[model samples]
Target chain A: MGSKEITYQQIYEENYPKVMRLCMGYTVGNESLAKDLAQETFIKVWQNLEGFRNESGLSTWIYRICVNTCLAEIRRERKKDKNLQIDNLQVSDSVDNATEKEDMLVQLYKCINKLSSTNKAIILLELEGLPQLEISEIMGIKHEAIRTRIHRIKQQLTKCVHNE
Target chain B: MNNFEDLQNKWQNQTTISATEDGFQSLLKSVKFIEQKQRTGNIVLTITIVILVAFLLYVSGYKSATFMLGIGLMICSLVVRIAVELYSLKKLRTINFSKESNTFRSDLTSYYSFRKYTHYVVTPLAVGIYTVGFIILLPLFKATLSNGFYTYIQCSSVVFLMVFSVFLYKQAKSELLKLKQLQLED
Candidate 1:
């Protein structure tokens, strides 16, 4: 196989899992949707790989594409059926011994959903262990801006999670 | 453990979605779909450009020919753009986000595909075509291409596009952050 094919395979193997996980965060662990969006994201990355000017890290570019893809999906949904609403959204329930971890996940999503889209992106990327500079690039913002937003978002999430 | 850090740490401790074959398969399929669509679109666009270039060369001596060619390219580009947009709209229309579980995901996938077209495919192509049109018309319209006017226009446009793109990106990012905040609310 050519280097291009090899690189594409490598990208698929290395980034696909992380992209799906990221999609899961955005989709609130709706596994099917997460998988679909993750797949779409990789397809985009592959299609545009030649245009990856290297100005930003490949991972950052990938994240940017993923976040934009997710947001665009949300926007499109909003337009098509104005009355559409997320149903039976699994909010964090009362903590129990057996389901504490699951409950935390649910609550985390609930709190995340409360965030503005950009803040959601910031917090999610932060949670995913992306660096500040990389987050800024993916977010198309200054590093200081990302830092400030992260600080504010964390404080906001803290308040929300505690109150829950 | 009661502090914000503790809360974040706990949140972080929650397990991620496990990787699975189904997920990979979906991703691969979507990628193939997008690739096919992009290829088709590129082919159409290239053909349109070739036709326009031929027209321009053929009618080099006729002012009407230049005008006709310009108008033709503009119309073709606009039509192609509209077709692409309509295709996206149609794809999006099929998604029922209110349905259980995967609906939002499907909607999201469509949305991303639309954005991928707009950002990676459409925007850059539009810009390039506009640049070409500008260049093509400069000579035909009797505008001096050597007096640094072209340079100034190009420079100014690039600056404007960069600033506008960045501004738009920031606003979108901020909006995404706001959504995240809203989702977090109790």
Candidate 2:
């Protein structure tokens, strides 16, 4: 294989699950939409691979792309129906089919969806085990702000899941 | 009550869809499809401009000042519209997705505003100029053609104008609505 293809293969293998998880959070556990958004993120990654500079870690760049792709979907969805809600009720409706852990996971996504789009991205990356510094870098916010936001979002999300 | 650490443990252990070997191969194909789609759009617009210019040249449209003015306006409108689209495409490519979220959003906001300006102002002006140019050529068409053909041409042009206006209005409205949504985000 050529150098570019080999590089892309490595990047895809290392990052796909992480990207998918982040997308799942953004979509409120809607696996189908998460998969589509993850694939779309990779498609963009493939398109812009040549333009990638090594200014940041490759995974961090991938996270940025995945976040933006999810946010873009929100704009597209809004254009179709201005008042369309995310239908988090679907997750609850299917709760009987899920394990206890899966039910909590679903509840976690529901709470994540309640935050603003920016906050959803912030908390997802935080939950994914990224460093606050890296999350700040990906989000273009100060490290202190990211730290504080994550702390507050965690409390808010915990209460939300408890209520559920 | 589950603590954040317990929640984090559940998140870490969550089952993720495995990326298969075939997925990369299919992704490669999709990359080609996307490039082809973008190229096809530009190709169609470029070919239209070429055909219009060639027809104008073959007719020696510059022989009469009125004909030149009318055709010139029409061709100019087409050329400018294509240039704007190409420029927008280039600007979209320039957006660095790897940048921080706020910077990325800022870049997008600018792009959306540029598009809004194009839709609200540039598009209407271009369509208006095109319509006027078509109108300017009507008297010539009436004088040169047989009465039946002239009537047909008049009817067809009016119908075409109505359809074109409605199409443009819907397209611009949809685009502007999406851009508005993007700008509204935090």
Candidate 3:
């Protein structure tokens, strides 16, 4: 019941980059979609900030919103009718004559897209250096499951990137 | 491949743009509009139901079977509107922002599908009932009013509602198609 009321502007300035990066993981490095998802995440955060009970970390709450926004975008697209799926729906991974490292990063994004949504959040947050426990709390899963899944998703991503 | 320092460095160093104040303002405006729409719809429908109840109470005192049946149908239509609104609100409430993306997708997909049902099926059925019930009630009203007045009121209301319903139906259909067209490519 404590009123540690942080303003939405402060939250947006501080967490926008991290949220955008996380959204990119969901979007296969598509920066436009990442930006939109980030915007939507912040919008939801702004709307729900008053209801935040201050029980857990702010990042956990914000990350939860980010994940949900990405999920909603996907869900909405999937539910939409089949005929008009062509409009801005595909995120361009437009790379022109990339080096080996950039190629690997492209492959990394492709593999990330292939992972389950839970595993995607797990590995992306892991990559972002969020502590595993916080990732678990953000995801509402057990700490051990997160630890185990991160190991599995890494193997999965490596094989996927290598096309093995 | 095992070296994630490069990836971590790339992510941490990512230069990003945030939503501007104008963007937030527009977003907040849209959010407020939607909330206001919900509130207004609920209030209007509840007021209608209450009025129907009071009217029904008064009408029941007159002891006319046709009038009672006519008012009963109106009450039914009000209930139908409330039911559809309640169903939609429930779906909106269930939208989970914290579930894993796949589960979240499924939940929201179902929610949209239900919404489509309400738009295409439920609302139309309710309107159909109201239109039929309104037509039926004209005879009852005729028992009291003069021929000229009844004809004038009847023509105006029926024509107005028929035109309005057609407009609404067309709008809803176009909206459904628009939603259908927004499918995302993988």
Model 2 has a DockQ score of 0.52
**Model 2 DockQ class:** medium
Tens digit per residue, CA lDDT, model 3, B3-47 = 455555544544445557675566556656767987898898789
lDDT of 2 by residue, B1-186 (tens): 688887777787777776889988887788779989988988987898789778977868357888878878887887788789789889988887767889888888888789888888888899899889888988888889999999998899889879988998887787687677667666
What are the Cα lDDT values of the candidates?
0.63, 0.81, 0.68
Across residues B1-186, which tens digit of lDDT does each residue of candidate 1 receive?
345555555555554455456655555666677778967977996897788668667766666655665655555565565666667666764553222122334455445545554656675576566556555565554564565777776787679768966975664454454444334422
Regions more than 4 Å wrong, model 2: A79-98, B38-46
Which prediction has the highest TM-score against the true structure? 2
Candidate with top DockQ is: 2
Residue B99 in candidate 3 has what lDDT? Answer: 51
State how far residue A154 of model 3 sits from its true place (Å). 1.1
Q: TM-score: which is higher, 1 or 3?
A: 3
Off by over 4 Å in 1: A78-98, B2-4, B7-13, B18-26, B37-186
Docking class of 1: incorrect
